[model samples]
Target: MTTTILAIFALVYLGMILGGLPFLQLDRTGVALLGAIALISLDAVSLQDAVAAVHLPTVILLFSFMVVSAQMRLGGFYSWATRGMANLPVSPPWLLGLLILMSGALSAVFSNDIVCLAVAPILAEACIRRQLNPVPFLLGLACAANIGSAATLIGNPQNILIGQTLQLSFAGYLQQAMLPVLLGLAACWAIICWQSRGNWQSSAPLPATPQLRSSDEQALDRWQSLKGLAVAAALLGLFLFSPLPHEQLALTGAGLLLMSRKLHSARMLGLVDWEVLVLFAGLFVVNHALQGTGLPATAVAWLAAQGVQLSEPWTLFGATFVLSNIISNVPAVMLLLPVASHELAGSMLALVSTMAGNLLIVGSIANILVVDAAARHGIQIDWRRHARVGIPVTLATLLICAAIFALRL
Candidate 1:
């Protein structure tokens, strides 16, 4: 049983690293789900144990926020915000600053992937209309969204997992993460502006209007947008001051939005990333099965004997940075959560894992969404273009976060 579970774990993570198994037609989520099924079929984990392995609170919180993001999207809030930012009567550099600020702030509260997905094409159009380079702005959007999602527990899926699993206070985590997130956003803007020097103007001719799906070009719905904003704002207040479980509060907010007369629940729920939730459930069961083998504890003991501790913040930081790049942030967090022990481990994992996503285009879903959206509009941003901004922004943000964490020592 132990050997079987170990093999499944290894293969699933390999799929994660390679984006899929060869000739398998399976992505990371599919691989993980299959692994869990294999374990259950083998009786390595019973159905009840498999169900118990999943952290329902984390899953619920993630689902609830996805619903909230869907509401905002349906209401045209994201596109509206992007248009509002693009239409600002500011210089190119100033506009870049505003873009970073807006993306970061919005991502800190909502789903960064959804935020980027909704904004990317509209932003491409805006840049083309303004005769400015869209690459840097698109890069900024990805980087800022990645950084900003580290600000709060519910900002991203991984953060939600870490916060709930570690029992970290929502307000407490925010206090620790806010400074570094702010610094990182500023760094993103600076690196983008500096690298894009004297090249803000668009050199290539653009179409009179961007080619977009009708849904992508949503007009602002004032009342619906206001309603979503109100729910989001109220949730933030509750998260800060109330003792209510975040999952429940967010679900309440989602339910309230679903009860709206115009927008249907199916529309909002359809936008939820069910695959991501399945990925989490699958990993939870697989990891729990591995724990039954007692290998993780033994490995920790072996590492400690060799003076290679993983529970320490610095070690965890390095591991998170490497693993996050290798297998993506959410899976990396799940793999490392077992070894995390420091009081600040959750914060370290959440921030480092997220900020590391900017290192490469495949490092985060947000980056992928932006790149795909750009491709749809004939705005190509291959890995090389992304790295030009991503590499520097990642380095600066990680360094700033490390420095701040050091001060806490």
Candidate 2:
């Protein structure tokens, strides 16, 4: 049973690193789900244990916010906001700064990946319309969303897990993280602006891509948008001020959004990223099974004797930055959470793992979604194009965060 569990764990994480198994149609989510199933089917874990392994509060909180983001997306709020930013009459550099700030703020409240998915195509179209290069702006959107999501515990999936697992205070985390998040956004803006100085204009005559040329900007329903915003705002207030259980509060907000008379429940629920939810459930089970095997504990003991203390903020920070890039943020956070008992452990893991996503195109889902959105509109932003911005943006944000952590340490 132990051998099977370890084997399955290794294979699943390998799939995560490669984004999928070779010659298989499985994505990272599918890979995780399969590992969980294998563990149960092989009798390595009881069905009850598997179910118990999933942290219900984190899953519920994550699901509730997905529903909230779906409400905003279906009402065309993201599209409306993004288009408005793109159309502002300002210089390209100023326009870029505003885009960074806008996307960053939105990601702090909503799902960063969903924010990028909804905003990217609209941004691509807007850039084309202005005869400006869309690559840097798209990169800016991805980087800003990543950095801004680090500002709040509920900002991104990994942060959500770290906060719930460690029970970090919402307002307390906000206070510690906001400054670094702001400075990271500033650095992102400066880096993109510096790199795209003479290249802001479209270098070639862009072909008439239908997605970019289409006039069907999503119809923004004022009433629905207002309702969603009000619910979200109330939830944020409750998160900061109320002592209510976060999952319960978030679930209630989702229920209210689902009860909408105008937006059918199916549409709102359908927009939810079920794959991500499944991914979380699968990873929880696998990680739990590994913990049951005692190897993780043994490994930590050996590492401690070797002078590599994971509980220290500096070591955890480096491990998180490295592992987040290697196996993605959520899995890395899970692997590190056991030893993350330091006073500042939650904030350290959340901020470092998120900002690390800007280091490469594959580092964050937002980055990948933006690249795919650009591709659909005939604007190709290859790895090279993204790395030019990602590398520097990631380095700057991580540096600022590390410096702040140093002061605390």
Candidate 3:
């Protein structure tokens, strides 16, 4: 049973690293689900044990935050933000700064993927209207969202998992992480601006078009938006002052959002990205079963004997960067989660893995989303084009984060 479980575990994670099983039409989520099903069938884990392995708090917290973000999206909050930011009569550099700041700030509070999903189209249209190159701004949106999500426990899935698993304080993690996040955001802007310098002047006038008005584009319930914002603000405040459980607070906030009249409860709930929740649950059980196999400790010990200690922050950072590019960030986090328990390990793992996404277009789902969205608008952002900026930005930001960690250590 132990050998069978270990074999399944190895194959599952190998699938994760490869982004699917060989020659199979499966994604990471499918691989995870299949692995869990296999474990259950083999009796490596009982149904009850499997149920216990899934972390309900993390799932609830993730679902709740997605609802809050959905409320904001439906309310035209992201559209309002993009238009407002674009209207500023500032130079490209200043505009870039504002984009980074807003993206980071909003992502810290909400899910970064949803932030990108909501903001990217509007940002693209705004850039076209302004006769500015949309590539830099789009890249900035993806990169900033990635960096900003690292600022808070609720900002991204990896951080949420890290926070829930380690029981890290919401406010405390913020205090520890804010400096590096700010520095990383700045690095993102600097790299982008430098790359876009001469090209900004060549931008043609934005073509005029008749389309939906701002009012028409406002798809969300106004009352629901206000309520969601209030709940989110209150949750943040609670994180700062109250000793209440964050998952509980966030779940309450989500419940409040669900009680909206203008938005159908079913539609709002439907937008919660249930597949991602399932992926997390499936991976949790698989990883838990793998942990029981004792391979993690044995692997760690073997590495240590060879002078390749993963517990060291730098070693972990490099490993995370490479693994993230290969497997994508979320699955990379799942693979590394078992061994990442150091005081600053979560922060290191989160920062490096997130930043590493910038190295290649495939390194993060956010980048892929941006590229695909651009293609719908007849724009192409191939890997080479992305890597020109992405590679440097990723390396520079990773170095800055590593420096921050080293200084604190």
Candidate 4:
């Protein structure tokens, strides 16, 4: 049973790293779901155990925010913001600064993935319309989103998980994370702007803008956008001050958003990324099953004996940076959750995992979403193109975060 579970874990994470199994039409979510099902089918974990393994609060919180993001997307809030920024009449560098600032700030409150998904294509079009190169702006969107998401526990899925599991204070985490996130956002803009110095316009004529069926392209509905913004603002207030459980409060906000008369429930709920939720559920069960086998504990003990204590902040930070790039941030955080019982553990995990996503296109779902959104708009951001900016920005941001976190400690 142990061996089988281990094998399943290995295969599933392998699929995560590669994005799929060779010759198989499975994505990371599918691979994870399959692994969970396999464990139940083989009696490695009982159905009840599998269900219990999933952290319900984390799932609910993630779902609620996705609904909120969907509401804003349907209201065409993101598209409005993108167009508004593009026409600001500022110089290219200043426009770039505003783009990074807007992307980072929005992502700090909403889901980073959703922010990138909604903004990327429209940004591509706006850049093309202005006869500016879209590559730096697109990369900036993903980087800023990732960096800014680190500022709040609710900003990204992984941070939500770390917060819930560790029961960290929302305000406290914010206080610890804000400086690093700001510094990282600034570093991202500088790096991208510098890399884009010689080429602000494509040599060839801009390809026809791909038809985007994104929520950003939806007609801007002021009332709906305001409604979403109001809810988001109120929720953030509750998060900062109220004693209510974050999940319950977030869920309540989602339900309120669902009650709108004009926006059909189906359209709002349809925008939820059920696949991402499934991925979280599947990984929870798989990781739980592996934990039951006692290998993780034994390995941690062994590492400690060898003077490699993972509970220490620096060790965990290094491991998180490496694993996040390998298996992506969510799963990497799951793997490291065992040793993350330190006082600073939650913030360290959140910072490293979130910032590391800029290392490669596969490093974070935000990066993938940005790339996918751009591709749909007929813009190509190959790995090399992304790496040129991603590598330096990642190193600079990680160093800044490490310095800030160290000071906090």
The TM-score values for the models, in the order shown, are 0.98, 0.98, 0.93, 0.97
Q: Mind sharing the TM-score for model 2?
A: 0.98
Task: Judging by TM-score, tell me the better candidate of 2 and 4.
Answer: 2
lDDT of 2 by residue, 1-409 (tens): 8899999999999998999999999999999999999999999999999999999999999999999998898887988998888898999999999999999999999979989988998998888888898888999999999999999988899999998999999999999999999999999999999998998998888746446433225579888888889999999999999999999999999999999888899889888889989999999999999999999999999999999999988999999999999999999999999999899999999999999999998999999999998888888998888888999899999999989988888
**lDDT string, candidate 1, 209-261, tens digits:** 66678778677899998988899999999999999898899889989999989
Kindly give the stretch of ten consecutive residues in candidate 3 with the minimal lDDT sum: 207-216
Model 1 segments beyond 4 Å from truth? none
Q: lDDT (0-100) at residue 374 of candidate 4?
A: 79
Residue 231 Cα positional deviation in candidate 3, in Å, after optimal superposition: 0.7
Q: Cα miss at 38, model 4 (Å)?
A: 0.8
1 against 2, candidate with superior lDDT = 2
lDDT for model 2: 0.92
Instruction: Evaluate all candidate structures by whole-model CA lDDT and list the values in order.
Output: 0.91, 0.92, 0.83, 0.91
lDDT of candidate 3 over 152-253, digit per residue (tens): 988888888888888888878898889988998998999999899888753554444325344225664557678878989999999889988888998998
After aligning candidate 4 to the native by TM-score, how far in Å is the CA of 396 from where it should be? 0.3
Q: How many residue pairs clash in each candidate?
A: 0, 0, 2, 0
Worst 10 residues of 2 by lDDT: 207-216
